[model samples]
Target: MSDSIVSLHEPGRAVLPAYVRALEAGWSPNTMRDVAPEQLAAIAADPDAFLFGLNGRGGKIRLHDGSEVDRLPGIIRWIIAARGPESQFVGSINLRWQEDASGKPITELPPHVLGHVGYTILPDHAGRGYASAALAAVLGEARTIGLPFVRITCDADNAASRRIIEKNGGRFVESFVAPFYGPGERLMYRIDLQS
Candidate 1:
């Protein structure tokens, strides 16, 4: 299956039956929360608004706990689409990082965040290399935006994710427990785009 990443803001109505299906199956694009009825209703009412809000284009970010945080430096989200006669949404990926009032991307992540890149593949879509391809594609987007590099993090025990990160030129940086993420060590890696 050929895979492509589509920005959530792109115009035109794209069928998202797969997204609905995933939601019905108890999947959430935000790993922090499940598919809430209210969120579902909002998405159903106006998907583009929901998606644009997710991109955090100069808007406050609402966390899973109902608190809002100031928008980070630069953030964007994309749906991983499997293209064919019937296009399907397979997963979601996003890039976020520290930024200054001048709107420049800073490589360091805020304390509340673990990494610059975060992604989730629907359970059914795992093991098909979608994660790797999507991450690589998003790195191109990151490069285009003038980011010198991106830091990605995964659970230290998640070998599959580590492989995907390393396959895309990620170099091991360090491992530490993120205070905001509870316990357990998380491995951090950096992929330099300057090369």
Candidate 2:
């Protein structure tokens, strides 16, 4: 069995070599864009900054399409599935605590984006159930925050992601064209937190 555990990114922590491995192996974040070597070096030197940037605490977010969005006032937690407390990083999950302007938990997500939770496992760590484990752990956090349900979206052709969502009790909602990302129709799945 894998010894992976999912936890929020911590500051001042040692940079896991697995991140370098992923980069060296050409695994970028879900954004699917290449990161500069200097930036990678900076991340390894201070992973806390990378986590902060991910959580929106550092300011804007640069998307894969080269668009930038101002960080909204919501809990953007970055969860990492690692082999152990001090092991390589296997995968990452982004758990966004959905809330409205009044800070109340929002059940429905904005129509533009894909989902409340997004995850990706390294190529070397594929087929190890890391995605499902990380998704389950983040769903627990969603329940803790009083979210009724969380929406997840994936490309219609991603059989692996479809299986992962299905294994975690995701129910099929509908298939819609994701105009924001591209022209392809994406599958939407919802997991009721209260269940």
Candidate 3:
């Protein structure tokens, strides 16, 4: 199986066709609420805006249950996994940076944000190990940012995501109910970057 090259999203220079393809194929970001007709048109018309809007500085975030809530404080880095340099976009990965009082990166996450890393690949690109490969690449970024470890979470029933995290050396921490996310219990995994 082929792996993807993960990099930060570049506006005018990055792959725009991939976003178009994803939109045409009806692929939405993992945390996006249902894309309305106007929103879809806007995305197609201006992908840069759509892509940049995924940045974490915003005040609101869409939950897994398709509801919106105030976002937590953290630095969010949006990334793309592509076939190669400037190639088709295979998927996306988001890394949230949390720091302690001393300004050191921390593994713990806030209530609104479930994990340190979140990712999603288009349906057509699923099952090709892209998620794992993308995650491994993102971990390099985490290391560059001086994170000691990262907390990753996924739906309890998502075996594929569990495997992806484990493939990247993630160890199960515990399962917990997110106060902001209603009844669904989420599984948490920790990947130590110091090792």
Candidate 4:
């Protein structure tokens, strides 16, 4: 969202105010353990978490998801982030990825890919261009962590998410279905940070 801001949590420490508020609002924390081994290690070392709208006891609860829980089917664990006006932490996004749809395994980190970009913003944060902002934040994190590329997977039906990925300079890589998940076609996009 324009005029809104997001902030990165301090290394290995939770922003108590935002975190407690999110929990009081019925939010849970996600762990990278939900994704892959490498992802888990990364999250563990960095402790990436997000919080949003915890600005007060109740200024009108905006929205909170993905930050506490892995909205993505393949996500094992994740952290929370926050965003606000005059602040700089408004949305939640993750650096995680799963196997390629081609049945090829990604047991090890790829030199060109940091992981997948999974971003989510609260309802109130939507429509004001917050999604792309969160995505940009994640990209910065990727660069800081020395990642070269990232993947983004979206449900074929979610045009909104697809648009967000496109706005982040994602290129159409393929459209396929994930195993044991469902018959729904998924759009996989790739963005290279090395450029």
lDDT, residue 152, model 4: 76
Residue 120 shift from truth in candidate 1, angstroms: 0.5
lDDT of 2: 0.69
Give the poorly placed runs of model 2, Cα more than 4 Å off: 1-12, 35-48, 55-58, 73-87
Please provide TM-scores, in order, for all candidate models, with all chains considered together: 0.84, 0.79, 0.75, 0.55
Please tell me which model should have the higher TM-score, number 3 or number 4: 3
Better of 3 and 4 by lDDT: 3
Q: Point out where model 4 deviates above 4 Å.
A: 1-4, 10-14, 23-89, 97-115
Where does candidate 1 have its weakest 10-residue lDDT segment? 3-12
Q: What tens digits encode model 1's per-residue C-alpha lDDT throughout 66-176?
A: 777877755544455554565466677778777667977778776777778888888887887778888888788788778899999999999999999999999999999
RMSD of each: 3.1, 3.6, 4.1, 11.4
Off by over 4 Å in 1: 1-12, 35-38, 73-75, 81-85
lDDT winner between 1 and 2, please give it. Answer: 1
Instruction: Give the clash count for model 2.
Output: 0
Model 3, stretches more than 4 Å misplaced? Answer: 1-13, 35-86, 100-104
Q: Residue-wise lDDT of candidate 2 within 93-167, one digit each (tens)? A: 666644677878787665545788877777777887778877787787788878898899898999999999999
Candidate whose TM-score is highest: 1
**Pairing residues by index, what is the TM-score of model 4?**
0.55
Which has the higher TM-score value, candidate number 1 or candidate number 4? 1
